[model samples]
Target chain A: MENYIPVLLLLGFAIIVASSILVLSWWLGPKKPLAVKLSAYECGVNAEGSPHAPFASKFYLVAVMFLLVDVEAAFFFPWALVYKESLQLGPILFVALVIYVAIFALGLFYIIKKDCLRLR
Target chain B: MNTVDIAILVAKTLLFYLIVLHVVPIMVWVERRGAALIQDRPGPNRVGPFGLLQPVADFVKFIFKEDPIPTGANRGLFLVAPALILIPASLTLAVLPFGDKVKLFGREILLQVADLDIAILYVLAIGSLGIYGILFGGWASGNKFSLMGALRASSQVISYEIPLGLAAVGAVAVYGTFSLREIALAQDGLWFGWLPRWGIFLQPVGFWLFFIASFAETNRLPFDLPETEAELVAGYHTEYGSMKFGMFMMAEYMNLTTISGVMVTLFFGGWHLPFVADAMLLKWIGSQNLLGLVQVVIFLTKVAIFLCVFVWVRWTVPRFRFDQLMRITWGRLIPLGIVNLLVTAGVMLWLGGWK
Candidate 1:
């Protein structure tokens, strides 16, 4: 909490800038709203059934799952950069990271074989 | 504080702040001009000398533009988003060492805002938070495009910041230092007194990883998915107008600064101008007085060069598809970051630098 000054300062700046922009845009930018214009844009086609229609879960599911594994793989990057220097940090951390990566990779392979990414 | 101290402090702060503001416009000019050259067209020639006043014209145009709040949007968050980003953008500079030193009034001064022991970690944490502005801006805008942009912004930042941190760890391993000044000074001389500058010569892979990761972290082209114009309109700030738009612009330039600063501190030797033939030039020119002016200039020049790179690439390279972006971060970059880290650690351990 004591060292929160920097974070706090940053938050304050964000709040200040965000508010000013909203106000300025409201005051200065053009404005015209017709029912058709306000409706969800469907790329020049007639109105869609609903703007908030539910999307198929598969695309998003694959995306999230990919991100999960993707993020996991990214975790290895930092550790790997420090790999040769691992003795200073702790010898076993490298081995642990290796095991961790192996397990993580196994999950990836399982998903790959299961065909989670296939678009049918 | 004494009168002299108070006067000096105020003068320094004002100068620093003003310079920070001024840098963005120069960067903008250079970017446009460089892009024009890259694309084989005149970028901006109408306004003033070398199109220098274009940013100023842009500022005037933006300020006069109307502000509009969507009828049912989250007004507070919409307004707060840009603030969140620009703040972190500026604060990261607090710990960067501009140069060795400068002298004034018979006293030496440090060119940095502050030198905390945990400078690197502070930069990482601050960098991570810059995304909140985009997140809030997009969320608050209440447009589907804005929301999509915000989500993409956070996701991309999270993915890229990891490798950026990892690459820097290799530098730390070899130098055994987290202080930016320490890192710069350590890289000052040639290995055999005539070899070359340093850092890049020793840790080329680490430098490349760090440089690439910084590019991606700043959301520049090839990695700029948050505001991917083709996909998400104008991205996070799609609903923004007037000053809110200005904030986004300001943050973009500042983020560019932050990335450049970090790059110089980590990879290039910061403010250590080579080809100096005189000892007095190194001594007198390095006093806190001369340093405050020289340090900022040196730093800005390095940053400006990189800003041109940003523009050059923006004009030259088409942005990656989302799948490709994800693949690069997850497959190529992360593994490379880890490998680089391991190699650095191995060398450091062998050299007894670890103990």
Candidate 2:
């Protein structure tokens, strides 16, 4: 955890730098608030309706798929760290890795078969 | 930590902060000038020699320009979004080891700002958070184009992130550690007394996968569907003006630099010159501090080359269609990454566990 101190300090420095720039820009920038200028850009014509309309369910499907795969990928990190040592010991760990990946590959194939990735 | 340790820490943090800050404008200049070169025109020669000062001029313009909050926009998220993006981009520098340790003030000081045990994990976690800036910026703007852009950007980032993580996993398995410094150190020396023992040689497929995924992660051309000017009208930041938009631009370039740094650390021998051992260089240089400085220059040179490749690709390739972008990551890259990981593990075992 001591290793994380510099990371925290770096984050603090970044926050200070980023916020200061935003403040500088806000302070120096002109603020002319004509109704036309303040309105959302729509090329030229006025924007109609709320921008919060429902989007395609495919996007939600993609998010769900991402969660599943990302968690699996996260698991690989710890396994990856120990993999070389485990292989040196025996083939058990290597076989286990293959099985784990095989199961995940099955899930990936299912995702592909369902066509969740198709943007059409 | 003692007072001296604290001071050293503060100095390293500031140094890295300045490096990331400087890289943004330099990248902006390179992008414009490189684009012009490819298009057969003189690019921004009016501002300083070869438009070197164009970024400075651009910064001044951004500060004085009119900044307006769109009438129906979410006031709070709109303001917080840019800083959210910039912070992560800058923070990633903490784990990147610029050079070997230098002896200074009668102490051995590591060149990295933070040498975490979980450095690779830290990078991956911070990198994923950057998408929120684009998502919030787009959603808060309450413009149709911005919303569409945010949706596209979020999904795209999340999808490509799988292949990116898998590629990193391949590196970790080969090096057998999550710390980036160890990975870089492991790449030292030679293979068969001829080739440099870089990660590229051990995991060639992983390198290519990582290289391609990084382009998508940074949202550069070909994968820049989120901010495609033709359709989305500047996409996520369409409603932002002045320095808020500037922050987003800075964040993009900073992310590019960070990704490039990570690539060099992981795949290309971090601070190690190709085929030249550190001890040999140390003998020639005859000073630890001087050797450290030379290593830093070497690391930066590698990163600069990668940055040039990024700029070159941006101008050379046309943008990918949204469906095609999604298809490539999902249909092609992810499967390839998995196969690559398995094959690497199998080969490592066959070669008697990556000595």
Candidate 3:
């Protein structure tokens, strides 16, 4: 708990710096808001369509795949730290990791087989 | 913790902030000059001697330019996005061990702000949060291009992060501890009386995977599809101006510095120069405080080299197509990272164990 003081202080400092600069800019910069100037920029062309339109399922697929692999990758850190110690204890832990990886690898294989990563 | 401990922590945090603030401007100068050198042109040479004061001029311009919020923009988010990016980038620096502890004034002082036990996990988790700035800024801008840019940035960061985390796991497997200070200390000796016992030598594949993923993670060229000027204009920050834009730019360079610092801490042996023995240095310096300062200097020098490499790569490589970026992350880097981790595990088992 004591180790976190600096982290908390650092966060406060960042917020202060960011806010100060922003406030400074607001105080110093001119603010003459014309109707045309405030409109969202669309590369010199008038804005078209809604920004809230639905995106492709591929992005969602990518996000799902990322969650699966990323969580799997997260497990590796703790496993790596204790892997050597566990190996000395017995092959049980090692085999457990292998089985865990194998299960995910099969999922990855299925995803690839389905061409889910393809950008259609 | 005592008063002295609190004092040291505060001092170290202040020092870290100053170092980051100083480095950001230097990086801006380097990027401009380096891009010029690579493209065979004069760049920003009019401001100060060799254009060293260009960042200062740019800073003044950013402060004075009017920041316009789009009429339909989410004003709250638009205002907070820059700071959101900057916070995590700065926070990631807290766990990085810039140098070993030094004795000063009858006590010991560490060069790092916070030397956490689970430094790697802390860094990875904080680093991933940086994408939120882009996401919020883009979505709130109410611009189609900004939204597209935000999507690209978030997806790219998320995809590459898997490989980055895995590569780090490979190194951790070899090093056996997540404490960055210990990892740096572990690489203190020579492997064969000639070669430095750096993480790069031991985990070459991990280093390569980390190197590529870091480029994507930092949103540099070849992976900077999010801000590819040919398509998205200025990308997520397109709706921003004045110091708001400066905040994003500063955050990017700060991220570069922090990432490079982490890379040096992990793969390049932190504060140890190749072929220089710590014992010899201790004997020569005869003061722990001075030696620690030397170590900090050494660490900064390595980070500087990495920063230069970042700029050089940015100028050299062309932006990858969005599809290419996704394909490379999911197809090549992630798979390679897994293979590298497996091989590392196999070797660790064969060696009996990691110390």
Indicate whether candidate 1 or candidate 2 has the larger lDDT: 2
lDDT of each: 0.67, 0.90, 0.87
lDDT of 1 by residue, B173-275 (tens): 6666677778777766555567645567657887787777776778888788888888877888777766667777777887787778778777777776554
lDDT of 3 by residue, A19-108 (tens): 899899999999999979999888788887787677777778888989888888888888888876677786666677778778767877
A1-120: candidate 2 lDDT, tens digit per residue: 877888888889889988998899989987778999999999899888888889988788889989998888889999999988887588887898889999999999999998887877
Model 1: residue B313 alpha-carbon error in angstroms = 1.0
Which scores better on lDDT, 2 or 3?
2
Clashing pairs in 2: none
Off by over 4 Å in 2: none
**Interface residue Cα RMSD of candidate 3 after superposition:** 1.3
TM-score of 3: 0.98
Residues B163-229 of candidate 3 have per-residue lDDT tens digits of 8998898888888889898899998978869999899988899898888989989899879988988
Clashing pairs in 3: none
User: Which has the higher DockQ value, candidate number 1 or candidate number 2?
Assistant: 2
Candidate 1 chain B weakest ten by summed lDDT:
B273-282
